[model samples]
Target: MLSRRHFTAALALATGLSVSGLALPALAQTDIKLTLDWRFEGPAAGFLLAQDNGYFADEGLNVTIDVGNGSVEAIPRVATGAYQLGFGDINSLIKFLDEDPSQPVKAVMMVYDKPVFSVVGRRSLGITEDPKSLEGKKLGAPPPDGAFAQWPAFKEVAGIDDSAITLESIGFPVREPMLASGDVDGVFGFAFSVILNLKANGVPEDDIVPLLFADHGLNLYGNAIMVNEAFAEENPEAVKGFLRALAKGFADAVADPGAGAAAVLARNEILDINTETERLEMANEMNIKTPYVVENGFGGIDEARLAASIETLKISMGLQGNVTAADIFDAQFLPPAEERMLP
Candidate 1:
């Protein structure tokens, strides 16, 4: 468990480095294991690209990247010390903190700054233009994760009746097919997963309409690097080294989106249901949207963004009753990367 004072001290130290020109001394080699948000896909490609390209080793670290079952599972696994770090959404992290403030899970890095979950419907529904058009239509949703919980806001922002849209728990898989075949008027899909699958099945982009949560008001940072609080406390230096190398990997992904897509395909043994072109496009989109690459440079966190997410989770997902941003994340492990000459 991390003390509140300890986190504040770390945040102060982390704030000392300028985003544009921060760097660190070369670190001694160490072994670190990371868990992913899900199985190999364009979304999880950056880690694969970094590992395959020797980015981690170059940073004087040897990392093992494990596939994850889901973001919900990913957070607790890291917090409980099953793994050093895991990829997750801010909502999941907040929920974990709510369950146990003293638990070790803390988000040290932001991966996706923009929320990726979206609602898809046919243009013929007239609901495509305005969110309210779906008044009497059924809206397909998954469980109580970020996507499901945020649907009401997704409808509210569009002036649609919150109750008008029926909540159908479609689970994670089979959501894309459910939307395409008209089994459901609309379903929840991420920019990378749902859109990719639809386009692959020859669903013309114009024929489909997406109501992304980011476009609405659900602006929680998604897909972050979470580490066990205990591990981060005991091995702050190791955590710092991990971020330094990860930033490099992210920069590489942004610089060469095509290579990044290839790395994902190779890692998974095949591309996702989407076409190669769509996969590449999704990769670049997700890369730029990642807060690790956007808000405060790669692998950094924006306190304001985090604060907004904390409120959203509490109001929308019924997360821990009174969790604060400080309770869910610690930025101290992130040193200024500009000064460090990463490998």
Candidate 2:
């Protein structure tokens, strides 16, 4: 019993339309709920910017991005179809699929070309920017943290003997504070995040030392955009369109990080723009704008490297050989290379 105008408006709303003042041609809209690997900090700018800039709408997608607790947690959410898409660690996703090959999720775009996993420690506690320094130290690690999950493989690659190391299963909230109090000598977390947080906690820059796993013989990919298999199967074009929009969003973020930070600030009012801007810049320089990404464009990975990573995971993560690189990633949804280049 709706009028023509009312019906049109309702259709638009149901299809995830961002209503403007003018009338426009009606098109079908697909709803996509995306769960991020962490809070709405600077790293989340690319996804947030795409949504705020109407790139998703341009692709006929009504994308709802939700904040998450951890990258590994996003896997089960996507696998269970609770979220149609997610951003998470591809390493964990590989293990998840190895446990059950039929999980309804697969990584579509590589976000962090360099893994954010690092061992952040204090110089006063005798920790250095060397992996061996961790051998006899007390380290705080959150069990669910993505970086902590890398230890089994990280220790193997870096040849760190844990016999003398003591581990504390601390919660995420207390990680920096504990380190600041010198209750723990070091912690496992993203280098940029941990370094900035330690500084925020009154730790001096000269006292902080970060030893990244990637720089210490771990050649693994990091977080990525993944989609639920069922949803992607039902809407392949929507999947493709989503990736395309994301590429545009990342490109825009790379071009103007301030704008990207503003988008994140819109979602999280409590965060400082300058800090968020710096965090965004770190992610851009350390992860998103790697030499490979800059040279080859963004959102795609080399198949050979992925295969090699899987082989490494077998030793580091104890994979049962149930999954392959192709099983974990599907690159067909990515846009053309030239279209994904950073400005």
Best by lDDT: 2
Q: What are the RMSDs of all candidates, in order?
A: 10.3, 4.5
User: How big is the positional error of residue 301 in model 1, measured in Å on the Cα after superposition?
Assistant: 2.6
Off by over 4 Å in 1: 1-29, 152-159, 272-277, 286-295, 319-321, 337-343
For model 1, what is the alpha-carbon lDDT of residue 229? 75
Task: Give lDDT tens digits, candidate 1, residues 42-147.
Answer: 6665677778788778767779888876566787778778899888766767776787787868888776766676777777555475666667787777763456
Instruction: Give per-residue CA lDDT, model 2, range 1-343, as digits (tens).
Output: 9998888878776775645665554576899999999899888999988998899999999999999988899999999999999999999999999999987899999999999999899999999878999998999998878999899999999999999999999988999999999999999998878988898899999999999999999999999999999999999999999999999899888889999999999989998898888999999999999999989999999999999999999988999999988999999898999989988
- Candidate 2 collision pairs: none
TM-score of candidate 2 relative to the true fold: 0.92
TM-score quality measure for candidate 1: 0.81
Residue 223 shift from truth in candidate 2, angstroms: 0.2
What TM-score fits each model?
0.81, 0.92
Which regions of candidate 2 fall more than 4 Å away from where they truly are? 1-26
Per-residue error (Å), model 1, residue 127: 3.8
